[model samples]
Target: MYKKMIKNAAGVILSLSLAIASCGMTVNAQESKDKPSVTSNSLNAGGRVSKNQSGATATTTFSRPGNIRAKAIVYYRLGEDDYHSEDVKTNNAGGTTAFAEKKVSNANVVGAKGEHRVVYGDIIWNDETHIGLTLPNSKLK
Candidate 1:
């Protein structure tokens, strides 16, 4: 009986190892092939829209092409004239699919001048429709 139990345990472990080894580890973005196609991209200072007198500086756009209902998050870099430069996240609102920002051309971190990490601030992907902290003021302003 002891020998039989040992064999069974070994078989179970081997089976479990094989199962885990065969599984994939990538994020499958779709629940079903029939669902709405989903897709995402980074929006830059100028692409699909133009900054106008009505407070429109930049615009970002993305699409979910899958049949399944999908969500998108856009990280925004906040910049204003009278305030220190910083970054924030916001969701798409009110018939708007584009993210507009004043653009930070000269924003940098403390003690990291000349370094990409210090100088360049990235607008991270917060969630579906951009949600993050606001940025600092624009030096150009």
Candidate 2:
């Protein structure tokens, strides 16, 4: 009886370990889905369109806090003359990083089959300088 109980306990422990390992993997996978699609060293920025193509998120990392901000712009366009821009900005006062994100549900223009054209993220220094970077376009359905 003692040996049987030990074996059962070992089996239960192994099963729990496996379950925990699988859960960790799932969390990592979800995080990778939100990873930035584009990064720019010059601007210290990253940007990506949402999986559903509804909007985008932008991030800028800074070494030290100052009069700095991060800007994210999501552009939608059906043609050269038809386009829209949605932007969001966030300021970093005394932190180590600054980021901004915005989602536009009505990104499509009226009566037009528009697409989420592209995403741009930038770092603005002292509210005067804008170092910008672009990411590849995301299609809209």
Candidate 3:
């Protein structure tokens, strides 16, 4: 009877040890998938997707608070010796936003002094005919 009782207690201890180890392993499994979870608040403002004035999307999100400012600027050379620009302001929660142009910017106009066409390589001129997408990261990407 004494030997039988000892064997039963050993079996119980072994089962409990296995259960406890499994619980610890489960916690780490969930963490692995959590870190890479992309928080797109900077890319999409709440629920609004960015739109490009050039009729093309140039939306992009960098690892914020690490590699970007709360606000950013994108420049497009408008004409001779001039440029058009846009600013993407990070929301109050440190999330940057994109313009309808899908370009990130601050509250200023900063265009690049290089040669590039507007989105689509086509245009319908009017008073609102923009020279190009306010922020053109397509080529950069």
Candidate 4:
């Protein structure tokens, strides 16, 4: 009877140890997939044409706060309805990348002139959480 009880107690301890270890591993894996830190460097729209008064440039600058590689998408909205975008693949070492365009013409303007909003986001390991920001608006020209 003594030997049997000792065996049963050992089996129970082993089972609990396995359960605890598995739980810790699961938690660590989830933490590793957490959302990445994103930083907005700058967003601007400039270079308006004086004669036509219908052209300008949009620039979106952003970076991640880690060494891991990630993907970013910079979105631009000119006026109220005109929208444009650019995709960037961040360097593995992690640094700021800029996306700029001067393609907006007279046709893209909502009215005589409008303000442009530049927004950007960085996705960590392609996870669901997207970190981003929308900078202050500037004249679309």
- Top-lDDT candidate index: 2
How would you order the candidates by lDDT, starting with the best?
2, 4, 3, 1
- Relative to the unseen true structure, what is the C-alpha lDDT of residue 52 in candidate 2, on a scale of 0 to 100? 26
TM-scores, each model vs. reference: 0.18, 0.35, 0.22, 0.24
Worst 10 residues of 1 by lDDT: 111-120
Local distance difference test, candidate 4: 0.33
Q: lDDT (CA) for every model shown?
A: 0.29, 0.38, 0.32, 0.33
Candidate 2 residue-wise lDDT, 1-141, digit = tens = 999999999999999999988884545554454444443344343333332244444444444444333444444444433333444444443222222222345444221111111122343432211222222354422
Give the range where candidate 4 is weakest over 10 consecutive residues by summed lDDT.
44-53
Taking the tens digit of each residue's C-alpha lDDT, what string does model 1 give over 7-108?
999999999999998789555543222122222444221112222212222222323221111122112233333322222222332112322333344432
Question: Which sections of candidate 3 miss by over 4 Å?
Answer: 1-69, 92-94, 100-141
The candidate, 2 or 3, that scores higher on lDDT is: 2
- What TM-score quantifies how close candidate 3 is to the native fold? 0.22
lDDT tens per residue, model 4, 29-122: 4334322333332332111111112322222232334333222232334456444333233333323333333345433321111122222334
| Stretch of 10 with least lDDT, candidate 2 | 110-119
Please give the lDDT score for candidate 1. Answer: 0.29
